[model samples]
Target: MKELSKRTAGFTDSVIRRMTRISNKYGAVNLSQGFPDFDPPKEILSRLAEVTKEDFHQYSITWGAQNFREALAAKQSHFMGRKIDPDSEIVVTCGSTEAMMAAMMSVTNPGDKVIVFSPFYENYGADTILSGAEPIYVPLIPPEFSFDTDALEAAFRQNPKAIILCNPSNPCGKVFTYDELKIIADLAEKYDTFVITDEVYEHIVYEPFKHVYFAGLPNMWERTISCSSLSKTYSVTGWRLGYVIAPPVIIDTVKKVHDFLTVGAAAPLQEAAVTGLNFGDDYYANLQKKYSEKRKLFLDGLDTLDIPHTVPQGAYYILLDISEFGYDSDLEFCEVLARDVGVGAVPGSSFFKEPENRYVRVHFAKKNETLNEALNRLADMRKKIAVKK
Candidate 1:
């Protein structure tokens, strides 16, 4: 048999997912993955039931169903503080996964360089590899998880084809401030680069840390390929509904890449999720309120247990410091955590591109009871760990 392609030689199965499997084997509360353990909105569920019975069982347009795009455009325009053209700017995709992949394929040429933040979502590295582009890593220094302007500018000076921005970030849960976005926008303009954003957690931001759309920045629309999803926003990961909103010139290419990639997001799912896109600001406000409560409950539990953890400003994830646990390998630590402690976490090393082995990620997008259970398990951990040390 012929040898397989060399491009994927460095690839491994997702560490986050591997931890989930370990959680299953150990029967631990699985918090490794970022998915919610609850149902989507009631309105969306009702619409899904209707779509299931209706003629939407058939495929819609290859890009998206027209009404879905229009609804999405209207909703996004209202929030983004700009007019978005439904026909020219939108491409519904299989997920933010596919949306980001399509955006990479749409712009990156082989041998090009793309700037990526360290401790990024795992898929960004793989996306660059798949697109045959080199990744230039910039560190988001820990504690506050703030970026160095000089370091970022240095990466931009490398003349990268694009930069992947995951605002309301994963693992560390850092939301980029407007000043930070402005610096990046200025650098993108200076270097003539594209900005491929994964803003899936846009609506899940906590108080005092707002989410600002990269495309909405002054003079950025033409170069920003904004990728987002209804998955986190609506608690419907299985539906795989995501989209790219960009300038007509860039989106034209994205539409083609997305067309051949998955041929569009699910037809019935898209039709159903239109209900969520049409949700007013009050719905989003309540979403923040709900997630904020989860964050408080989980963090308060950790504090009571005297565990060290990063306080997240946005998104549903928390990074707990494990340096004092005396574990050298985050991978082994996570497995031990799952098997012995009865709580699952993704190794922080899996997300960080740097030599990081001192932390692990856990999420709280679960019901109150589930969060309580995970916290209970975690409280048991402190007892076992303190005795060992």
Candidate 2:
């Protein structure tokens, strides 16, 4: 009968998950939650089947399984352009969700300020609140989703404890350029602030854009806590395998936080995903090619229907403009879109700190046939839902 947790009292169910439920209710093609409809790599799947019969049933190390850490360190070091010590520099988490939460808790105290970009993944907001950190939201301007240097520096001047960086950002899919990242690095160094990154979409970048690892920047290795996951890369969101890559000191705290939080990521799943972590470069190259094709197919279909959208530079998400629909709330529009147009979307408002409602976010991570079906249903959108005057 006592008051429930004040930190989470205002929270509603995740709009992304809510829309997926709505999609199921209406028998719509669910594009709201960003999970692939296709299967994971045959190699990993084959290994997973083999592992169930093996001796990975019990819990592994509290921080991570030994072989999983080694494989992840090797894979990440190759791309991140540095040697990552599997023993001291990593804490495998339940997912990037727990990775971010643990990172937030590790670095921040109650009432400490953490800079977060507007139009962020919804979890960033919740993570800050749950960690007892105050969020300083700086807008990532719409359409291009770029932030101004002056505004970011101004946020830095507030003496925040840390900043949350989402490279190949969700919803908007803006891959932060090296120059942009340099500015952030400079500010972080000048302000003596920590940089906690969500690099979940690190491998999913498109052509002409690249994922620059924040910790790889000069003088940033000690101050950066890089949180990422195997979920997106391996198409195994349900497996919940993610980790924090930071300096030994920071990771020491993260390991403690992680141990108390989830004890460890699923032992068998981590063992299975180690197969994916050890995959050759050819696998990543093929993944890039496959996502590129899907992006083109989906965006081109939207263009053919004259549906206005923001093209993603990295991730599989697209933000569709619905300004002409005249709906006061994008949430209502998304529900109607699911019920009538037979496609699901998350209201853009859920991702933005600002009062925004002119767009809804959909993903192209489904199979080609699934995307085509969604596109076909979307072609009848205007006719299906009358535009209010």
Candidate 3:
């Protein structure tokens, strides 16, 4: 071959997914990926069964099925505190992955620069590259995962086309607060930059933290593209149902990008997921309660093991600081963890643009039994994987 696609020459298989394979190869409890080990809501499951016989097996409208969009708009409008016109504002995609890609492609040109927070979900890095946008990485300083004001404005000064915001951020689990969102909104308005948000974990927030929708911020509806999924909220990662909600002008372009990219999200899954979108606030409250318990269970185990970790405010992920283990690479530590310690985690370095290598990310989006088993296996870390002096 003369040359493979030069754009992808540097791309590697996703480390999060790679760790899932390693975990399976070693018969370890897989906490490397964020999918729930438990089942989705029974209502959604029941609806899915009914949809099989209802001819939703074929495609719906390429943008989305009418009923699904109406339900989604109602649900989202309630939470976003604004009216959302389903017909003009939404473009359903194969998943938030495609939703984000469509948004990026719709907003960016080949030489555009987009701001990406370091230690973001790995896909954002690939999304910017695939969209032909250069990424300007600003660090969300560790510990609290807070960004400095000057650093953010400095990135804005680069005249970027857009910025990717991962609310309840992955790998670091930092939920952006209202004041922080205001700062971002002000800068975005000042710089005339757009914001593309990944909000798959919006409902998985913990106590004392909240997920503020960027589109709901002042004067942001026009410049914000909200990309989210039914994956985390409904625990249906395989369903591949996600969407982009934006102003009609932007949604028009994103709809075109989405149509050429994947046409639409799964018809049957979208129909089934409507049960979840219409679920009352009680469901979300219960979800928070369940995840809060899991977070406590896992964090307490880490504490007993004397491991230092970042206490997340939202999302189900935890970043275990492994510096004391004295490993040269987080990747090596993760390998030994899966092989010898019987647990799996993503090497933290994979998610960072900085030279970071002392952390590994794991998730607790599993059943109590699964989380307990992973925690039990993790108790062996000190005995099994210490570095030699």
Candidate 4:
């Protein structure tokens, strides 16, 4: 038989998902994946129940359901500081996963180059490969997770087709400030590059740190493809409701790609999530408050245990420094940690283009009880997880 697609031949199962499985096998507290352990908003859930009895079972429009798109546009426009036309600027996808894939497919041709910041979410690498694009990884310097303007400009000099920007970045949790974003905007304008953003954690930002929409930048709307989802915001990862927001010409192409990708996001789920999109500012304020509490509770526990970790400015993830544990491979250390320390984490190596092994990514998007349980188990970290012999 012919070999499988070479594009995927080197692919391994997702490190994050693999760590979740290890957590399960050992009954460890699973903080490896970024999903919330708590329930989604009751309002959305209630609407979902009612929708089951309604006529939303059949597929909605291929681009998106009309009401869902309108709701999303209104909600996003209020925050993005632009009036988004739902009809011309949206393509509903199977979550940010498909939104990103569709965006890449729409903008890039084979052998095109895309700028990706290193220590990014692992999926960006796969997305570029699958889209037949080469990735130019610019490192997001650790400890501060800031980028050098010179390095970024050099990447842009490569005449890349696009850049993948994760605002409240995963693994490192760096929120791109307005100044940083402006630098990116300048480079993108200078090089005529598209910016594909993953802004899933937009609403989960902490105090003093704000999420600025990339598309809101001066003259950026035409060159920006904003990909986001209700997964992180509404705690509905399984619902798979995400969208690409861009100018009509770009979105026209994305709609065609999306139509051929997953048909459309689940119709009933889209209808139900509309309730969440219509939620008031107070709902978002309360959501930020809840995540702030979780971040404090979890990070304070790490401090109490004397574990060195990066304090996230926006997202729910914290990168725990494990260098003192004397592990050469972060992956093996994560496996041993799940087996012995009763906690699960994604090896930091998976998210970096560099050979980094000093940290592991863990999330705090859980119920208070679950976070407490994980903390309790983590208290015995040194006693259980030992250095390599």
Candidate 5:
């Protein structure tokens, strides 16, 4: 028999998903994946129920349902401070996962280089591989999760075709400040490269920090591809609704790629999510408040356990430093954590470009009771591990 494609041969199972499986095997509180354990908004759920009764069952448009795109365009444009032509600039995707892939495939050619920040979303690496692009990783030094501008500029100097930016980043929860975004924008402009962004956590920011849309920067809208999902905002991850906001030229190319990829997102889901798109500002304010409360609850528990971690400013994830455990393998640590500690986390090494293995990421999107239970189990971690270690 012929061998499998070498392009996919090196790909391993997702560490986050693996931890979820381990969590299930041990009955652990699963915080490995980033999905919320709670239900979506009542409005969205009701809209979905209404959609099921309607005749919007067939595929709408290959790009998106007309109303859905218009609603999304208006909402995004209002926040992004830019005029967006729904007809020319939007392609609704199955999820941000598909949007990222579509964006990568649109701009990248085989053997082209793309700059990826270390401790990035794992999907960025897969996007590069699937697009046949080589990734050049620059470390975002921890604690602050800030990158050295010199290092970033140097990476761009290598003539990368694009850079994947995840603002309000996952795993580490770093919200890229305007200053940071400016440095990257300048580098992109100077290097003549595209910027593909994953801004899924745009509304999940904590106090004193604001989520900056990278494309909102001067001269950036033309070169930037904004990929985001309604999953987190509306708590409808299962709906798999996302979209790409880009300039007409890039959106034109991306729409063609998206057409051949999935044809279009699910029509019913898009039709239902249009309700969320037209939601008021109060919806977002309440979302921020709820997530901020969850963040506090989880972090307060972690503090009691004396677990050293980076305090998240935006995203609903925190990266705990476990270097003092005297182990250099985060994967092993995470496996033991799930199997023995009754909690699950993604190995931070999986998100890094370097060979570091001293951190693990946990999601705080679970219910208060769920997080409390996880914390209670974690309190016994040292006692439980002492006997075995």
Candidate 6:
């Protein structure tokens, strides 16, 4: 028999999903994957119910349903401070997962290089590999999760075809400040590269920090491939609806790729999500408030246990430093934590380009009681580790 593709053999299972299985095996409170344990908004749910009987079962336009794209374009344009032609510049996808892949395949050729920040969303690495592009990783130094501009510029000097940016980043929750973004934008412009962004957490930011749309910057809209999902914002991850917004040229290419990929997202789901896209500002404000409360509840628990962590500025994750535990392998540490302490987390090494066993990523997208239970279990972790020491 012929051997499998080398690419397929080289990849391993996702750490986040693996931890989820471990959590299930141990009856642990699963915080490994970044999905909300709570329900989506009532309005979204109602809309879905209404669409169930509607005639949206058939495939809509290969790009997107007309009403859905129009609503999304208007909403996104209002926030992004740019005009968007839905027909010319949007391609609804299965999810941001598909959006990323489509964007990568659209712009990149085999053996091309792309810059990925270390400690990035795990999917970016796989996206690069699947696109047949080599990734050049630059570390986002720990605790602050900030990049060194010099290092970034050096990577850009390598003339990567693109850079994947995840603002309000997952697993660390650091929102890229405007100043930080400017440095990257400058580098992208100087290097003549595309910027593919994963902005699923655009509305989940904490107070005092704002989510910046990369395409909104000067000369960036042309070079920026904005990939985002309605999943995180509307808490309808199962719906698997996302889109890419870019200049006509890139969007045209991505639309062709997306059409061949999934032939557009589920029609009913896209139609239902239009309700969410047309929602008022109050809906977003309330979402921020809800996530902020969840963040505080979870972070306060971590503080009380004296676990060192990076306070998240946005998104639903916190990276906890566990170097003092003396374990050189984050996978082992996470397994022990799940089986012994009844909680699950992602090993930090999975997200980094360099060897790192001193951190673990925890998600705070749970109900108050669930988070309290996880915290209660974690309070005893120090005692158990101390005994081992």
Using lDDT as the measure, name the better of candidate 2 and candidate 3.
2
Worst 10 residues of 1 by lDDT: 380-389
Angstrom error of the Cα, residue 385, model 2: value is 0.7
lDDT of each residue in 1-389, candidate 4, tens digit only: 97889999768999999999999999999999999988999999999999999999998999999999999999999999999999999899999999999999999999999999999999999999999999999999978899999999999999999999998999788999999999999999999999999999999899899999999999999999999999999999998889999999999999999988888889999999999999999999999999999999999999999999998998899999999989989999999999998999999999999989999999999999999999999999999988665
Off by over 4 Å in 3: none
**How well is each residue in 102-187 modelled by candidate 3, as lDDT tens digits?**
99999999989999999999999899998788999999998999999999999999999999999989979899999999999999
lDDT value, residue 291 of candidate 2:
97
Q: Per-prediction TM-score, please? A: 0.98, 0.99, 0.99, 0.99, 0.98, 0.98
Once fitted onto the true fold, the runs of candidate 1 whose alpha carbons sit more than 4 angstroms away are 385-389
What TM-score would candidate 3 get against the native? 0.99
TM-score of model number 4 = 0.99
Residue 215 in candidate 1 has what lDDT? Answer: 90
Q: Which lDDT values do the candidates have, in the order given?
A: 0.92, 0.95, 0.93, 0.94, 0.91, 0.91
RMSD of each: 1.2, 0.7, 0.8, 0.8, 1.2, 1.2
lDDT of 5 by residue, 1-389 (tens): 99888898878998888889999999899999888888888888899899999999998899999999999999999899998899999999999999999999999999999999988898899889999999999999878889999999999999999999998898788999999999999999999999999999999999899998998998899899999999888888888889999989899999999999999999999888888899989999999999999999999999999988889989899888887776657788888888889999999889887887878899899899999999999898877654223
After superposition, the stretches of candidate 2 with alpha carbons farther than 4 Å from their true spots are: none
Candidate 1 per-residue lDDT, tens place, 146-183, comes to 99999999999999999999998987899999999999
Cα TM-score of candidate 6: 0.98
lDDT, residue 179, candidate 6: 94
Q: Which stretch of 10 consecutive residues in model 3 shows the poorest summed lDDT?
A: 1-10
lDDT of 2 by residue, 1-389 (tens): 89888999878999999998999999999999999999999999999999999999998999999999999999999999999999999999999999999999999999999999999999999999999989999999978899999999999999999999999999899999999999999999999999999999999999998889999999999899999999999999998899999999999999889888989989999988988999899999999999999999999999999999998998899999999999999999999999998999999999998989898999999999999999999999999999988
lDDT of 2 at 162: 99
